[model samples]
Every structure is written in C-alpha cells, then in structure tokens.
Target: MRSFFMPFAIYVLGLAVFAQGTSEFMLSGLVPDVADDLHISIPAAGWLTSAYAVGMVLGAPLVAMLSIRWPRRRALLIFLLTFLLAHVLGAMTSSFEVLLGTRIVAALANAGFLAVGLAAASAMVGSQAKGRATSVLLSGVTLACIAGVPLGAVLSEFWGWRSAFWAVAIVSVPAVIAILCAVPASAVDPNAPTARHELRALRTPRLAVTLLLGALVNGATFCTFTYLAPLVTDVAALSTNWVPVALALFGIGSFVGVTIGGRFADTKPLQLLTIGAIALLGGWLLFALTAANPITALALVFVQGTLSFAVGSTLIAQALYAATDAPTLAGGFATAAFNVGAAVGPVLGGIAIDAGLGYRSPLLVSAALVALALVSYSVARNAAHRSNHSRGRSPESF
Candidate 1:
C-alpha cells in the first residue's frame, strides 16, 4: 500500500505542477498574441510574465508561513483551486489590467502549490530517494517546457490566446480530482515544525548557501534560456522556425539531465554539484565562443540545458536535506530561491545586450554565474569538512 500510494501521490502532485508550470512558461510564446488582443504594447504584455515571477518570489514564503499549520492536502487543494479560478478569470478578462491581476493571483497559487507540493513529495520518500522524488515532481515543469509551451503557442495561433488559458484550466480539472482521491489524509503531521521554528531554521549556514547556490545556478540557466531565440535566429543564422526546435531540444536535454542526476543526488551530491558546475561553465563558454556556428550553437544549447538542470535539481534536493529541521518551509525556500533567479537572470542578460555585448553575451553571463556558484560550492565544502573534522566525523560523511 505504501509503495503503490507513494508513487501515485507524487505523480499526482507532478501533474498539478505540470498544469501550473505550463501556465507559467507558456506565456513567453503567447506574449505577442496577448499584447495584440488586449491592445497593449508588447513590452506591457511582457510585464505579465514579470508579474508572475514577482508573485512567486513574494508569495512562496508568505503562503508557506501562513499555511504552516494546515494539512498538506488541504493547503494543496486550496492552492490548486485558486490556480484554476485564476486561469478561468484570465480567460474571461478583456482588459490588460485584469489579465495582469489574474497572472499575479495565479502565480501566488503556483508558488504556494509548489512549496507545499515539494514538501509533500519529499515526505513521501526516504532520505536516499528524496532527490529522485524531487526530480519526478519537477519533471512536470520540464515537460511543460517541452510540450506545454509549444502546445499553448499552437492553440493561441489557432483559437486565440485565451484558448490557451482555457486549456490550462481544463487540463487542471483532472489534477484537482486526483488530488482529492490520491493524497492521503495522513499527509498531515501534528509534529511538523512551527512557523517560528521554520524561520529559525532559515539561519542555518549550509541551507543559506544551498539556496544561494540554487539561485545562482538557475539564474545562469535562465539568462541564457531567455535569449535563446535571438541566439538561434540571429547568431546561429537559423530560420525563425528553428527557434521552437532549439527550445524543445533544450527542454529534452533538461528532462534527461534531471532524470539521470536525481539518481546520484542523494548519494553523491557534492560530486554532482562539482562536476555539473564545471561542465556548465565550460559548456557556456564554448557556446559563447561558437554561437555563430549554427551546428555548434544548437548542440551547446542542449548540453548547457542538461548541465544546468542536473545541477539545479540536485541543489533543490540539497536545500531540502539541509533544511531537515524546517520541513514545512524548506520547499518554500527552494521555490523562492529559484524564482529569484528566474526574475533576475534575464534582466542582467538584457543589460549586457543593451551594452552592445550581442547575443553571445548572455552565455558569457551564464558562465560567470556558474563560476561564482563553483566558488560558493568550494567554500561550503571546505567549511563542512572542517566542521566534520572538529566533530570527529570522516570527511566522507559530508
């Protein structure tokens, strides 16, 4: 019963994440349509995306704190319902302002759902399998990047942008039903950490660095990903049609990365991080230097995506492990940290481009970020080693 139910519940949570992540990422492809339909400029429509990121960053910790005492299943249900309603409202809205408001609301729901969902999924598995469980949950987001975003674009192209919103809301219905049936009432834990205790746990040095590492690594990925279209069409000299293909390839690589990396994350996290960071830095640098060559650019995009998520997923698991004392809020910390990177990466990349650094500049920016992440990892590892030695534990225990 435990075996059957655990995987089933985790997959159900992943399905919910798929629905939410589709809405989060599909906007990039639908932005032009959204602007035209609402009679807003493209730049204004782009704010819808930014608004979602802002909501996630602010809402994750806030909602996690507020719902700390709630049953995981109950909190998840509420968040999923809010998410569904936001999409419905968004689909019905004619005004850009109303649409923007709906995006924020949906994002808040997404943030809360993700935080709670991560905690729930992690709790379902043993310590050794936590990384694999995290990957399974996050695989939904990867699938969103691969299939959902493209499907949304196609739907918008045929039936209008609102149809995409409707599609998300529609698909989420099954997830809502599954949650009701699959998520056990036993998910509630009376011994769960209180908000104050969770807050104090955030002060842990290892956890702090882990969260920062997640942000840095994710920022690097997004900084390059955000500008992939320009890189493909302008720098690589590929046709505009090749953009989606490149994006899809990146998504595919990410899926592969997470699936493979998750297996080793719990047993060899430090090694995964060390190798992934170095490989990512080298990959990004090579991409920057060879982006004008179409074949090399496309290949490197896939490689970079693989390395990024391999490391990124492991960082998330590390955060959960490090925050073992704050089980309730660990997921929120991870969510907020990743979203912070999502918000900041593109801005810095845009700044570089505005300074005439060209399409390859973002790749360089990614490399630099990875370099910093590597330094952080080194410092953390050394500190952990010293602490372990002082406590008479073998360095291998770290």
Candidate 2:
C-alpha cells in the first residue's frame, strides 16, 4: 500500500514545490528590471526579496496553526490558489509598493505549501523513506535554481520582468491541476494533536537543538552564497559574465548533494551530518584562501555548494524524528528557521564587508558558523545518548 501510493504522492507534491520555488527564486533575476520599471533604486528593489523572506518566517507557524486540522489536500489547494493569485497581482501591478505587497502574500502562501507538502510527503512513506521523500520534494528548489532562475532572467532580459511573473502564474496553473487530480483527498486523523499541542512539542531539548543546528547550517551556506557574485567579480577577478555560470555550477552541485544526502539520511543521519561538517570546514577554508584565483574559486565554489546542501535532508529528518509527537508544527518551525537564517545571513555578511573585511571574509564567516553547528550537534547527540542509556536503551531506538 505504501509503495503504490507513495511515488505518486511525492511526485505531485514535488511539482507543487517546484512551482512555489520558481516563484520564490525568479525574483532574484528580475530585481534590476523591476527597479528600473518601478523607479526605485536596486537596494530598494532588494527589499522585495527581504519581504518574502520575512513573510516565510512569520507565515509558516501562522498558517500551520490555522490549517493544522484541515485536510492536507484542501489546505494545499488553498495555499496554491493564493500563490497563483498573488503572482497575478504581482504581474499586473504598476506600483513598487503593490509589487512588494504581492510578494509578501506570495511568500506566505509558499511557506504554507512547503510545510504542508513536506509533512504529507513524509507521511506517505515509512520512517526509512522519509529522507528520500523530502529530498524529492526539495529537488524542486534545486532544479529551480539551476534552470528556472536562468530562464526567468533571460525572459526578463528580452521582454520585461513582469513577463517572468506571468510565466510563473501560467506554469502554476498546471501544477494546481496536478495536485487536484493526482493527490488523494484523505481524511484527517481523529486523534491528531491540536496546533497548541504541536507547539508544545517543540519544547523537547533535542528538537530545539536540532532546529537551531538547522538554522545555523543555512546561515553558513547563505552567508557566502548571498555574496557570491561580488566575490567572483571583485576578488576572483573574473568577468561579470561568469557569475551566471558560477550560479549554475553551484546549482548542479546542490542537486547532486541533495540526492546523495537523501539516500543515507534515514539510517545514518548522524554520520551524514558529521561528513557534511567536515566537508564544510575543508571546502570553505579552501574557498576563502583561493578566491583570488578564478580556477580555484570556481572549483571550490562547486565543492562548497555540495557540502552546504549535504545535510538538508538529514536535518529535516532529524527535526521530524525529534518531534514525532507533533510533526506538522515541527515541519513548519523548521521551514521558518531556514528562512530566518536566510534573511539574517546576508545582513551579517554585509556587516563584515562594511567592517573592512574583503569579499572573501564571508566564506570565513560561513566556515565558523558551520563549525559551531557541528559543536552544537555533538552536544545534542551526546545528551540524547545519555538519556537513552539512563532508560537502558540505545540511542538508535529513536
């Protein structure tokens, strides 16, 4: 029964995720055009991205609380409809303020969709397959980074930035249809915990620590990633033309890393995190030292990208496992944590740059954050082991 329904469920959910991620990231490519069209400066245009991130940080828990008792399929449908409508508004808007508002609405919808999609995908599988299922869903975002962003940039270049928004709305129409047709309208569990209960579940020490680790991991990755273009052109002394190529390479590395990470996450989550930490330490150290050379910079960028995403599936699995009593709320909180880190990482990196650190300094900040994450993870694991031992059980019993 699990085998038969799981694949179809994951596939439909992945498509929905692809649609949401495309909307989220395509804005990166359209910011300049948007600034010009709306008579705003580029930095002011950048707030559109920040607005979306803030929406995600706030919306995940808010929407999760509101819809926790609703049927997953129904909630998903509502979220998708909201997302599509927001994009339509975004495309048709003439004022920058209107566009910003539309983006915030869209991101709120995206956060709801992602949280529900992750929980539903994991529920379709046994514990052993949860990691793989999550990876499949997240692949949507990775694929968006690789192809959707570049294509959106191209469209904006030839037509207008609004064209790209219209295209996303158009593509999302089929995705909404796919969800309706392919996903079953299952009944909600009668004994399922309420949103308040789920929120309480977050008080577990291991769950709290794991969520913190997840946030730090994301902060580490985005600290450098948000500044990658400047580092490439200013420090690596590469042509500005190479920025897109470098982005594509990083996307490729992310795809591969997520694929590999998903496979081992269920059975060897601790091992996966350990390896990811080591990779981050080594990769970023080399990246910081070699940014002055184009060849070394490119090679290390791909490597760092792979290592950066290596813990993604495992981190989600860990959070869900720790919060098994309240999976939906846990999932929402995890999404919020990641977005919070995404918003904060860039600010921290900008501060470093303002303090007279070179462009390569962000990579150093990335390495330090990852190292701290590794330390935090070790402490959590040891404490979990001690608790298990006191109960005369192995930690693996989890």
Best by TM-score: 1
lDDT of 1: 0.89
Error of 2 at 169 (Å): 1.1
State TM-scores per candidate: 0.97, 0.96
lDDT of 1 by residue, 1-398 (tens): 22323479889999989889899999988999999888999999999999999999999999889888899899999999999999999999998998999999999899999988888888878766778888888889999999888999999999999999999999899999999999877554677789999999878888889999999999999999999999999999999989988999999999988886777787888888888899999999999989999999888888888889999999888888888877658889899999999888998999999999998899999999999989988988899899999999877443
- Residue-by-residue lDDT tens digits, candidate 2, 1-398: 23423467687777777777787888887888999999999999999988999999999978877889989999899999999999899999898999999999999888888888888877878666777888888888888888888888888999999888888888788878888887778898898889888888888988888778888888988899899999999999999999998998889888887787777777778778888887888888888988999999998878877777778657877788888778778888889988877877778888899999989889988888888888888887888898999999878633
Clashing pairs in 2: none
Name the regions of candidate 1 deviating beyond 4 angstroms: 1-6, 394-398
Q: Candidates' lDDT values, in order?
A: 0.89, 0.84
* Cα lDDT over the full model 2: 0.84
